[model samples]
Target: MTTLSPARALPSAAEVALARESSRTLSAYLQTRAETQQIEIVDDQGAAHPVRVPVSALRLLVDLLTEIGAGNAVSIIPIHAELTTQDAADVLNVSRPFLVQLLERGEMPFHKIGTHRRVRYQDVIAYKERIDVERNKVLDALAEQAQELKMGYE
Candidate 1:
């Protein structure tokens, strides 16, 4: 597990709470893309990049930012595409911890940058496509049954 050191003099509880109450969604955890802050990250290919992020994604970025400010999260924002563990989780509509399980199970490919892990956009898309195919198959079976009933009482 990665150890995170809390930043000094970051946003106060009142400030975060106010932000939370305003958004009333991510609970100050995430803001809109335009409103959220920027963060930098490095990809598996050893390339540095910057990532423009929304609030949910930016929350983690903010922590990473305050940890190693400037050249840290904000600097690497340029290379962000299908990035971040939480973003992958968002794509899958599951928790980040669960997505980490998928990564461990070899269901998704991810790479480690220093202590952080990053997931690819294509991998999430492929997983989504796979799920859609399975769901379609079930729907098709039900449709076939409906067609049979339409033909007769069976």
Candidate 2:
């Protein structure tokens, strides 16, 4: 399989609008249809061709389009794919040094390819989710404490 380079920017306003419309169409079609069998694609010359698309691939496309529609830049990396430290850092929105620290501290699992450490995409995502959940729990506790103390306007 061929891997595409990462997109470096958020979608343009026009692209986002188009993506939103396409996402809505996909959503509506999926909602009404019992099963997705095949779809027709129109060429630039207005020629229609029927093609078979897997339901899983279609679902992924819909999700990607939805994210793009929300003005977010999306990356398609397989869950089992391995990533470099810098790539993992970028995905987690953390500094490379910090990611290294996490790896060193055994917070996330990694395997060394020679001298270089490689982490699985799934591992990074799991770590991010765990961090987010912990952060949310702390925030919730703080909010409760603040409410008990009657701090600020509820």
Candidate 3:
């Protein structure tokens, strides 16, 4: 299991409440035309500052807030960051041996730094995207087959 140091702390009740409120507000905005435009950030002193962020970044922010609102700890890692084999395996939710096998098979890219193997965060994310696509395809095929067999609800 992963362990956090003393410096890492969970969000307080008030913080969680704010996160939940922000999540709801952001979700509502994201579902409307407001999502296509930039947003303003208000400070604790009621000072509003306008900033334009990429839609993808805003989406990520919403996800983070949602998780935080649900009392989950969040970590933001840069896409170009290098991770150790164990860290990469943890990110992929696989065993180190399995990750090594994938690296050996060229399914995921990795490089050696001195005696240690490092994997790019982007590479792991790309692999996850491919796996998700493949899984969805198989699921769709199965649903089609089931429909042809007149199984389940209409």
Candidate 4:
């Protein structure tokens, strides 16, 4: 069980601009049907290193860059990583007490390690997806009701 660190600060304005440009270039290149791509890295000594990377990894990089470009902070957690209750709550954008209640109610799976509760990253994500689907369903139902009532919500 690995613990994740707290998220870093938001990207600076210059970083956002650079990320936007880089993502645009990489995204355009990714439009090709290639399985892999070669990229060059220049060291401090001005030496160039050509490295081959998978398209999947490049796609993920592009996504990270896109988020940074939008001035948003991002963190990458492995699917199998374990998270503390607070960390899980942060991921779900909820209070720690609320997350604890959900855990106690068995809405999500968790385990205790020396009196501390730990939740799997995958489990937290699954719970979030489940609630998101339910919320969307209720929203759709409400929209339909509003339309039927001629409430001008259409």
Better of 1 and 2 by TM-score: 2
Candidate 3 structure quality by residue, lDDT tens digits, 52-128: 87666778889999988988778877877888888888888899999999999999998997888888988999998
- Please, what is the TM-score per model? 0.41, 0.88, 0.66, 0.92
Give lDDT per model, in order: 0.64, 0.87, 0.83, 0.95
Question: Roughly what TM-score does model 1 have, to 2 decimal places?
Answer: 0.41
| Clashing residue pairs for model 3 | none
Model 3 error, position 30 (Å)? 10
Residue pairs with backbone overlap in model 2: none
Candidate 2: give its CA RMSD in angstroms: 2.1
Q: In what order do the candidates fall by lDDT, top score first?
A: 4, 2, 3, 1
Off-target runs (Cα >4 Å) in candidate 1 are 1-82, 146-154
Which is the better candidate, 2 or 4, if ranked by TM-score? 4
Which candidate, 2 or 3, has the higher TM-score?
2
For model 1, residues 1-154, the per-residue Cα lDDT tens digits are 2222232355555556554444343334453535665556789998989866666565654455453432232223222354678877866789999998998998878899888888767777788899899999999898889888896535
For residue 110, model 1's alpha carbon misses the true position, in angstroms, by 1.1
Write one digit per residue (lDDT tens) for candidate 4, span 1-154. 6877777999999999999999999998798788999999999999999999999999999999999999999899999999999999999999999999999999999999999999999999999999999999999999999999999976
> Where does model 2 exceed 4 Å of error?
1-4, 32-35
Give the best candidate by lDDT: 4
- What's the lDDT for residue 22 in model 1? 43
Report the alpha-carbon TM-score of model 4 versus the true structure: 0.92
Clashes of each: 18, 0, 0, 0
Candidate 3 at 16: error in angstroms? 2.2
